[model samples]
Target chain A: MQPDDLSRHLAPILGDRLIAVEPFPETAGRVRFRREGALDLFRAMRDDLGFRHFSTVAGIDWVDHREAVYVLWSDDAKQYVLLSVDLPAGDPRIESASGIWPSANWHEREAWEMVDLNFDHHPDLRHLLMPDGYTFHPLLRSFKLHEPEELEVKARHV
Target chain B: MSEMWINMGPQHPMTHGLWNLRVKLDGEIVVDVDPEIGYLHRGIEKISEDRHYNEVITLMDRCCYVAGFSWEHLYILAAEEALHLAPPERAEYLRVLCDEFQRIGSHLMWYAAFVQDIGLMSPFLYGMRDRDLVLDLYQSYTGARMTYEYMRVGGVRNDLPPGFSAEARQVLDWLSRRFDEYDQLTLGSDIFRKRCDNLGILKANDCVAHGVTGPMLRSAGVKRDLRKDRPYSAYDRVEFDVAVADGADVTARYLVRLEEMRQAVRILRQVLDWLDKNPGPVMAEELPRWLGAPYAPIGREGYLLKRNFPKGVGFSAVEEPHGEAVAYVVNEGGEHPYRVKFRSPVFSNISAARKYLIGYHVADIPPIMGSVDICIGEVDR
Candidate 1:
């Protein structure tokens, strides 16, 4: 369907929580929603809008606030609709889309470890790209990186 | 006998890359599988946040060694969108040329590795020999076999050299004949069929739910190619069919990848024909001064803080040789991207290992995972 179709489907369900559903070139449109109504919007987007295929969930550190972007595709509509949710920088937590979309599992894990966005109620949120016990979230703007330095990595005893 | 966990990688013959597959086996049958990645992780996304827009092309080459051009094309598509730049018509066709050739090269690499995993010795060498021809074609124009930082933001770095299309056409012709030989070597063998048929079956719903793309999804009878469904770059201009199969098994994946190579040859012919008639500028003329020359020094006044740069987020999904690869670029009005996240198809394909691998024989892991075409660079990037 088109942008208007998405707008019409999501309007009554989301009410004021749905920020906007504007037309985006090369895509059906980008659907912006508040973090509070994430689960409601995700379910509606999946079952109601026919966007069964979930592509990815990327977390971006906007410095002041954190942004969680979810890309969903509809086989029926033959289009992609981007769903972005904004969260507070200090404690960036949002309802996990993994419950609605099984594909969101790995994407959520990556987002959580990299950008420090907490996926509340995620089935298994763990360090995807980082070693276990790794402390820093390297994707954050505050995590400063320097030139490669030689270090002895301790081997784990079996 | 009791069930026990076996580590198949971190340097196992079954694993083609630097990752571990911990499989729990109950008398040669796989009880469970846990894929442990991050061994090859170089933090490419975090590093992208510190580089110039065009300079990020260097890292794309390291993403997937076999499909560097495809990854480069993916990043440029997103970076261009984020920066609000448009490439020329010829540049678009040239990019298509890069993609189709990369598809052949990557499939050849996959063919070599997958067959070798199943003990098909001769076809392994044959696959590499044919792949070398594609790499030769890449070397002639891009000046690098593996890591050609040829594609720039807005457009490519340069136009095709003289007689490049003729040479490319010759390689395509050779590859088409070799495809028949490839099929005969693998599909013709009884042992090949015995090892592959009805093995590693992942249903259509499982494929979609796990976010599997590329040939794996296509093998499951899903016609969800981004090129056809959501045509990007010069895919809209070309006429080609999406390669698909209904088996959703190892053999079906083999057929899908083989058919896809032929289709890539089909697309390359069209792209080359279009390129021969159209000759134009490769790079966009309206680019900012800093982006024009990525490495050169600018005046004391840094263009990194340029106010004219329109801040936007660029999302690009390309049907890479492996699968559907997505790149999200956040510009945020800086020379460096605020954030860059890549969705590697292999990552999700590997994540669903527990779904497909659990019930299969432990011995079947190689051909199954090999058919998925694990590229650790992109998976860990």
Candidate 2:
């Protein structure tokens, strides 16, 4: 499963929404797609492509735009495939993959709290690693570690 | 009976770490479960952005305390790929040596705690006593029992000490014998079998759907050991079997872990033999001056030298003691990584607590969770 293979397979389903499939180290390829085709692509990858194992979802803050990378593994292929989508920084939101892959539930929650990438329609979209009422996305570039800031954390289920 | 939620953790013997398991129960039967983690969260990924490439190894040690070397190796593999560097063959073998030994050490720790959870008290002492020997081997070379910051970005910090192989073989010999005694204590005991058998059964499909791995996944008879499926480091060179069982229950998990320990011993024997037969450089040459020096101070020199470095994204997945641990590193021609993301397997395993915990009796929580081998340090990292 190379970049060409992924591009050839995913192009028919995603069409123009499917951007270029670039070569990534170790894995088959990195599938860059439009945010509009997130759910469709996830379904195609899981049902059609036999990527049964959804590994994780990671959020990267590019400062200008935010990116969410979904790592998937196919037991039949014995390989990993990465799905990357770039969202505008001001309102970084996309359809959640939890519906397609239940494993994406916690990963999406972490991405939402840490990088502030909104996974629209994510069930239980709340603080995962962060405390309740924590307002800051600590993984963003602007969240400096050197500076001290006041924090207000409300106890959960009090 | 009315349904009510009960918190099982934050400080519970079954938890083995800091986290809360909110179990909604109808009398004795579990109705639902919501695990509240983050008690041990240290924002390791956030902190990695500020540290230098090599400096991140320190935090990896704390990422998973029992499996420090495995985490260190994971981060190093990713950082090396992002920087377009590779360790020497000898270094790869040394890493395999570290990984296999760490697996044994971690499993021993899990075994100790797990048996205690199931009311078998004596096995806990036996497991800890045996694990100390493995730690002694680590202490002899890495100079730290738990947090061994020995692996560098391109390679390990140093080679094994003289006569280390002989000492390690002795410990392995002792452990191989102790494994049978462990089976006698647990498998032979009626209390252990009655408590653990047919308990916490997460079948192969549920395991894959919920992103479970390591012993829990293998217990469902999934021959999906990453070392065999996707060989990394010196794993391709070693000879070992993927431990699998069809039970998919607590006993199945126990069987898988025990077999995995045996296979780890088998891998260590081969790695030790290879280390004895071959002698070469552990650290890779042609590294930049800042990263090449074993004890180089974190300074502006690294920043200056990294200006011309090629930028790349590195993704590495290692079959960690708990499960599959992944590290993604992005290098944007800076001394520090632009972003570092980790996928801790325990996190996903615990997230599926609701799937397995519900429908079981309240008294069965300890043995069920014990089989999952919860390591909250990595989960909340």
Candidate 3:
């Protein structure tokens, strides 16, 4: 499918919430959406577009604003579609996609802990790769490796 | 009996790497499981932000020690895409050679470990002894057996050595025969069947929901191999079958992985023939001055000229031996990646432990987890 095809398909459902559907090499398209419409877009992508296979949910700290990228694959289309949403850095939170895609469970957990993005209503949203009670978000732009800080990790039950 | 949690490891034989599997048991049956990771976490992703693009290939080698070449290929493809650089046709064929060989090597390692878990003593030695041949092939060109940092961003660091194809072909012939012997050792025995058959059956729907890929997902009768579905590298040129089994048990996983090894050999034969016939450039020409240098020379006019390369996000998913490994690289017009997030297949497969491990006997843990092929280096990276 082409970029314009994706935009046309999501137009009715997303309306103004859908941003530019840019063409991405190897993928169907990069669908940019408003953070508020994450849940609705996820459902449409999965149910309507046949992107049943959900891959990765990655969070990036773009300094000014945080970005949440959801990479999904369609078995029928045999192509990947990237859903990107930019959230304000001050309060970066979006509705969790785990309800629609159960595979999002661990990916969301890793994203939450690593980049410190809040996946609202993410069940079992605890530390994944990080130690419990570890106060640093290491993947952020501000977390410099050269700067040495006291590191203490407390053990906690999941 | 009342339920109680059993900690399998920070150090345990069942765990191949550093992680803890907390199992709640009622007598001998597992009622619940909680896996605690991070023991092997070295912040590779965070460190990738600081290092140059070529330097990150070193960490990919360490990602999954058994399938270092596969991970190296995975990262390199994405890095090359983000930089808008296309490797030569010969380089793509060479990558297929590396990937197929790595698949064989990784499955052999899995075969050794899995059989050892099930008390099959002789095959453990057999598996390792055979895997050494593939490692020898890697050491011939890459100079490192376990951690080969041979893949560069634009292309491979080097091409196949002299007479490498002939040597690789011999190993392929031996492995193809050994696969039949493997089936007789495992599937031919009734005890192997009793221990593994119908054990830890995660159905196709459950496997999909849990994001399980690779042999584990294929063994459940879901024939989704990324190489065939989304052909990357020279996979499109080569012909092979997707190994699948319907049992969805420990034995089924074994069968699928063993068949996958055969297919890898088939692919290697074709790739080797092509490599022998065609000889061309490996790395892409017209590369920026400081592509592979550990530290790019920062000149007096560093600030202005660095913006020559346009920013792009490169995402790639390769059917790793463990499962589907995805790497999303953000190149923000610099020597280093802005952000690199990898989706380790074992990470998601292990996350679905509750679905598979629950209600099985405590003794069955080793065989079931063995089938999953836990590579904690990538899991906790």
Which numbered prediction scores highest in DockQ against the true structure?
A: 2
State candidate 1's DockQ. 0.78
Q: State residue A40's C-alpha deviation in candidate 2, in Å.
A: 1.0
How far out, in Å, is residue B225 in model 1?
0.8
- Provide the DockQ value for model 2: 0.87
Q: To one decimal place, how large is model 3's interface RMSD in Å?
A: 0.9
TM-score (C-alpha, index-matched) for candidate 3: 0.97
Q: Cα deviation of A1 in candidate 3 (Å)?
A: 2.4
Per-residue lDDT over A84-155 for candidate 1, one digit per residue giving the tens place of the 0 to 100 score? 888999889999888888889998999889889998999998777777767678788888789553444443
TM-score of each: 0.96, 0.98, 0.97
The lowest-lDDT stretch of 10 consecutive residues in candidate 1 chain B is B293-302
lDDT for predicted candidate 3 compared with the true structure: 0.89
Query: How far out, in Å, is residue B109 in model 2?
Result: 0.2
Of 1 and 3, the candidate ranking higher by DockQ: 3
Tens digits of lDDT, candidate 1, B1-381: 999988888999888889999999999899988888989999899888888777789999999988999999999999889888898887898898999889989999999999999998999999999899999998988899999998888778777779888888888888899999989999999989999999999999998888888899999999989999888888999999999999999999999999999999999998888888877787777876666633322343444445447888798999999898998898888678988889899999999899888888888999888888999999998
Q: Name the weakest run of 10 consecutive residues (lDDT summed) in model 3 chain B.
A: B293-302
Alpha-carbon runs more than 4 Å astray in model 3: B292-308
